[model samples]
Target: MQESVQHKGVTHFTIVKILRTFSPDEMNEFEKFLHSPFFNNHSTILRLYKELKKFYPLFSDKCLTKEHLFSVANKGKSYDDQLLRKYLSRITKLAEEYLSILQMRTEGIRKDYNVLLQLSRRNIKEIYTRKIKKVEKRFNNFQQFEAEHILHKHFFSALKYELLNKDNQIKPHNELLVDSINNLLDYFLIVSGWLLNEIESHSYTYDTGSKRNAVVAPIDRNMIVEFVENAISNLHSEDKDRMIFLEMVLNDMKLSSPESGFSAYTNLKKLVYGNSHKMSRQILQFYLQRMNVYCLLENLRGTHDMHLDLFQNYRKLLEENLFGSEGKTNLRFLEFRGILISALKIKEFEWAEKFINENVKYVDEDLQANVFHYGYSLLRFYTQDYSESLSHNSKIQSGLLPITIDSYILKAKIFYVLGHSDSALSLADSFRHFINLNKLISDFHKQNLLNFLKYFRAIIRLKAKNNIAKAGKLLAELQTSSNTREKKWLIEMTEDLLKLK
Candidate 1:
């Protein structure tokens, strides 16, 4: 539609996005769905669907415009503007209906479980019993803690649904049944509490990082944190090996202390490594996700040793064929960044070089340029290829302002290292101005970066004037700052200047 590009492919693109996101198999299934009279009855809608398929992989304006689509859809019949618009509307609804059906079919457990709940509530005894066995079987097939817990939701729901039935002659009040029910309720209470904390934490994380409009949820801050903490403490004696219990512990650590989350991170590693084959793919995926989050947390905290642990963790996930599946780039992209940083942290240039070249191809084309260049630039910089480092990072164009501030700090360091003192000083000044003006950049980050810029500019000045004595005084002042970025690297450079005498 020529209505507005603002809501088009780059943004919303409603029906267009749904169709283009389909896999080859999904597209075929969608075609069958369209042909089935149960989903679509209008001939014009069918014609519209056929016309849209021709623009697959790239639903460009050439064939996607309403004029062309209407012209082709009502070939022999003259196109009535009103009729054409109705045809598009009907076809759009058909596409939406098809997507809903496909999602349920692909993820069938939730649908069947919901139906089981409904059937149990209606006191449809025979069908409810049959569905119960089927649901239990499906739930049992899942080895992930999330699956068990999700099923536990349904399990407890079904138990309550059956319990409420007036037709039930006798209530089974067995100890194991009652105990199991109570435990699941407790586990779910923790899940609910942890979800609340995560929602609140994101509010804080974003509030400190960006100027984006945030919808504040009205809730007590301290109460939820205390609830989750007490829940975890109460549940810790819970089968320690159980996944839901482990997740609650890890999530609490992630929310409260990212650096301290390292211990929780190790516990998750043991669970995955020891029981991956016994676990469902869903649970393995969840474990990998948490591990990566912890990896990032540790990296942000400047914990240097975790660099090697992540290298092995990513390698193991890849070996299991779980790291990147179905051509997804988001996870692979995170792993790429993590591996690159970890490798550079320990100076494993050979492995870093191989990983960068091989893994960049897996990154989505839209993101590869900006994302990989940032990693490659770091690798190049660490390997002493200063020129190429600047060349690669020049194209990085870090998207987030906070990350951009760090990139500028890196660029200044590169310039100084390459003996471009004037450019380095100019860049430091530009960084100071940008940080001062950007209200979006949090005060915490601004102060840290300001400390970096001040000490960095001082070092550049002293080196330029061949004043080693003054450089030492500035380095001591820089060391005293409460928080500073690139502390070790800055100290190393300053010490090098001191050594020249």
Candidate 2:
């Protein structure tokens, strides 16, 4: 049956929005959550839940109208909008509670700490001590020294000190107090360093764009850097704490000065791999990702060639299975593209194909086909299979700004390479207009893409006329210009044009 127009309000309801976000498994879990008497006792809400669930993800059924919902929920009664709203508001609250509960389930250490605090308040000595020992054992067995671990360690140490002090019969252990304080300081220092690094990076990213109105941060970043550096200098390089401090400093260096970015990146990479054994999987992933970002920016700056090195680091990440966190098997779309682009940049066609085929399943189900097609499009283009490349490129849909823009560039390049100059030029004009009109894209990205289109159109027109002299001039202009995206592709195209008789 066609959905009733009257049901539009219900379809666009807030509860419907919340429910649509739930996966099939999450839907089942939410049903179970509602069934719990402690969570929902009203029979009317249960009836409403049954009615609403029938529509599920697409709550557009004609029977899904508000009046129908009212009849189903409160049988043998006249429709009442206020009462229906009340039930909906309650269910929405319950759905929100379920979300919080889901998040809480993932935070095992936080939950344990909460239990420990409550037990201490109740002075449940035996059980609290047992819980402490259990958690301590878990921590001891835990190899991942990520932020959570450090925070939990501090919590455990401080609680241990408090517990000892609570006992009047025993002397307060000064050693435990000292240990707690040190852990606390370590947590502060590590967290502060990372935050400062982000601040330093943000300043470079936003401030350098001429069109962007940069927001000055309130605090002096230099003072924070200075304090962190001074504290880190006291610790040896072998110490895990010192490694994080150095990583943050290097991260700042990579962003602060373009001249020294590559040098900083190399040293930061050494720090990461050198202490890979001592560090947790999460920390390794973090630093590797940071290094990749530096490489990407430096390469985009058109001052360095970090493409192959970035690809190699991605290989290391893939080898170590550091792309996903514990229990998270899905590869993010951006990470998938990052790996694909890095491989394609170095013309590793076979490797790129293998990665796409093997790992496409790890992308979100909805994005699997489009992501696969996009990767293959680039791969085919790099291999000079223009027809096959366009075939794959045409399969790409308008989603994900980066993928959409890349597919546009890919399709235009395929047309250009296959001697379809008119089509390439037409597409370049439309793409230039699209880039200018897009508001979500940053000014920096807009300028870069516009630069790509400008050079792209020139290359196509020059190649079509067989103007070798002008193409040579354009090639030099491109080489000296710093504001271009796809610098490598444009350079190669211009160089190819020069070779044509």
Candidate 3:
């Protein structure tokens, strides 16, 4: 049946147009009819709200008038307190009807809110796992579009609220949610950014007249630098209380250019000095030792001044602490060992010998082996002490301690200086074998080893004075394989050996 409505000058026959033109009192009556039990069903609520909202705005001053209220009320029907209490008559009855059914339908899909609350209170990794599962489920499958939408909207909103709230609902669990959220956000940002970069960069080719094509883009160093700077800036200051945190930061910063490392080290040193706490002092020493070790290993002569200055300050700190009754003895020994190495590098042999002799008793088995081997090599090559050096070398080799290539070169040089041609040749042969076994030789040390071997062989030939052919052959090999610095050293040594011949 068609409905008819009269207007000022027109007659409306459609039901929708009649509702759209209804008076405020009539619209209020329609709203009451919509919320009643007769229209409680989802489809009925939706249909009535759709028709009544067009004219209902004129009847209410509230933002979500009767029409909007009806929409939300229908969604809340099974869960709403008033409806559940009136219809189910008991809380258990309502839970059995609605909560149990939803739980069964979405079992193992949504994370348990209670479990999440507990885990968040403790900052457990299990909480992260549960959150990931919940996020995945919300984003993946959906039996009803509305169900999926509500789940995601509410879940994220609740998570954000929990993370930002400072009050401790759980005892002794302050900032746990904040830390977890930061970690998760960082993980997601790093992974998604990498994936996005990989996807956006495409490799393609087009052929034209038998031509090949290529595409290339230079790496952005500035972006990398900015990322590192921002990362350092954002690290939690509380984490700096731990020794491991300072070590990790220093190691990461060291991966930058040498200039960057020096700058960062200076700033970090100042920070540690300013703090002057026990942990800060330990951290400062750790970074100082690490940076100095790297500089020595890389032979970065440019930073020698900075290295010495820092090492001196670190040694003083260690000494002052170690001499005290309650000081750490092991740390004092480490500082003394580092100073000995630095003195050796700068050819301060007297200081090196004095320090080693004074602290030799406190040195452990590992330090004994390293010190004896290195000290023997130095004494033999630089101080020209044959018997004493040989005694130490025999001890190191008998102990089967690992020897560096530089140590082998120094031993060969010592044998040549002592006129033990056979011993020098054997040492050179062992050095060559070591280099061949370790295929990944550093460019700096490779040249140094080649030059040392060449000089040793040349001296042997000079002593024999008749193996001219063998001598020339060795010199030719040195010239062919040598870098610029090595070639100059080889040429000078060859000239002197030829003159002797």
Candidate 4:
């Protein structure tokens, strides 16, 4: 009799989920990893892995039945549920180890650090001294550095000092301990600065008037700002520029409003342009993300024209390939959409089209269709090809919440422009229902979209009536509204109404 097709928890196993994340190359490499005697000794686990590999990528329901797995992996042995479970568990552990090994290969210093620890435990003074000097040399010769490097330097110093003082036959190096403390403080200041930036960025969500949930140590942000400024004045190291950029970011965060943020923003842009080469890719990418956030915040305030600034920021990131590892782009769908929209906002049609074609492939395969259609639809809409725009927009069926909301909004805009008032208003109402029913969208975002719909309905009505004064009033409200999405487009639409009269 053929085995029953029930999955019986095999397909949904954690091993299957982990395997799904592996690329084709990784899958083949994992097979070799399983064959290594050092990593895996169980033959049945290998057999189980072979059975699992038959259905490699999907491991669909019918292929992952418990009965089938047991029979195939243990051809002659009688079915024992506990035994099969043990084999599955063992293989999952092996897979996890393989992943760790992969990570370890990329971090060579981590391996040496552990080796130094092992040497220290054995009190192999001669080899330990030689290895410590080698590692310190490697660290000194390193051209690029991260904040973690400072911490690692401190760790090595501590280890060296301990080794020297272990037997107390000779005095410890007092200078080494001081050097370690200095490195520790540098690490603390850098990490604390980053954390402070994050705290201030999200400070809008907190209610200061609400009762406290717990007693926490109060941080004086102004004190840190003052200390950082003082340090910048006295700094003479290679890290002077990096420290200066951190101070600039902190200053930008200190600005009470987006209107006042422009000076800080300009200073930051100039500093990055001059010192990007001195920074590591990780640091540069992180600060670029913050710069983009500042640009977006200022743009939302409706005072500064930041589209060109945003366009340049994205161009730098893309040119440097900082969004992904190994010289390839791997943008999340939302990030891809934001970049394309930024290019569109600046009317860089040719560059935007080329960017979409070049980078759409970097988005996950499942999201590629929606990203492609949405990008082309925006491009078509901007270039005034309404019919083609609608055609591309209709092709997006990803069921992703943001894509759905954007698709509906784009459809409504196209219909309104084409004089299909009834269809346009109907879609706008449906969009409202979608927003109200969905709990996934945060209150902040929900309010933004609802505000857009409110202004959208007003613009449609104003166009039909050709009320020039009301159009001007609508434009003014949209310009000043801080909590609305699509404010720029709505303002332009309302301006078109004034021209109509």
Q: Number of clashing residue pairs in every model?
A: 0, 0, 0, 0
lDDT of 2 by residue, 1-501 (tens): 334543445866889999988888888888888899999998888788878888888887766788889999988998777898999999999999999998999899889999999999999999999999999898878765566777778888888878877876477687766667656765665566566557655544442444356555554545655655666776665776545645555454445455666676777777677667767676677677767777776677677788998898899899888866655567988789889999998888889999999999999899999998888888988888888888988888857888888888888888887788989989898898888777667666677788888899888888878999999999999998875788988999999988886
Which stretches of candidate 1 lie above 4 Å from their native place?
Answer: 1-13, 61-65, 121-123, 147-152, 155-165, 172-240, 243-251, 254-306, 309-336, 395-403, 462-482
> Which stretch of 10 consecutive residues in model 3 shows the poorest summed lDDT?
2-11
Compute each candidate's TM-score over C-alphas.
0.79, 0.79, 0.40, 0.85
Candidate 2 stretches with Cα past 4 Å from truth are 1-11, 14-37, 50-61, 168-213, 218-225, 236-256, 274-282, 316-333, 358-373, 394-400, 415-440, 450-483, 497-501
Tens-place lDDT per residue, model 1, 1-501, is: 535632233213467777778887877777788788887877777777787887786787543566667777877675466786577667668778877776677666667767866886687878877777776676567655555455455465547445445466465546436546655755654455446556643543333544575555454435554655665566546455453444544454443454555565666577667777765555566556556555544443445336667777776666566656544534545456666776787788898888777777777777777777787788889988888988988887657554486479778989899899999989888989998987775555566678778778888888888798897887686555555667667778888899888
TM-score (C-alpha) between model 1 and the true structure = 0.79
Highest TM-score scorer: 4
How much is 137 displaced in model 1, in angstroms?
Answer: 3.6
Candidate 4 TM-score to native: 0.85
- lDDT by candidate, in order shown: 0.66, 0.79, 0.48, 0.79
- The sequence of per-residue lDDT tens digits that candidate 3 reaches over residues 348-434 is 677667666665555555666566555655555446576677667656543221246445755665676677889889888888777
lDDT of 4 by residue, 250-285 (tens): 564554344456776777777777777766787778
Instruction: Name the lDDT of candidate 3.
Output: 0.48
Query: Model 4 Cα displacement at 458 (Å)?
Result: 3.4
Q: Is candidate 3 or candidate 4 better by lDDT?
A: 4
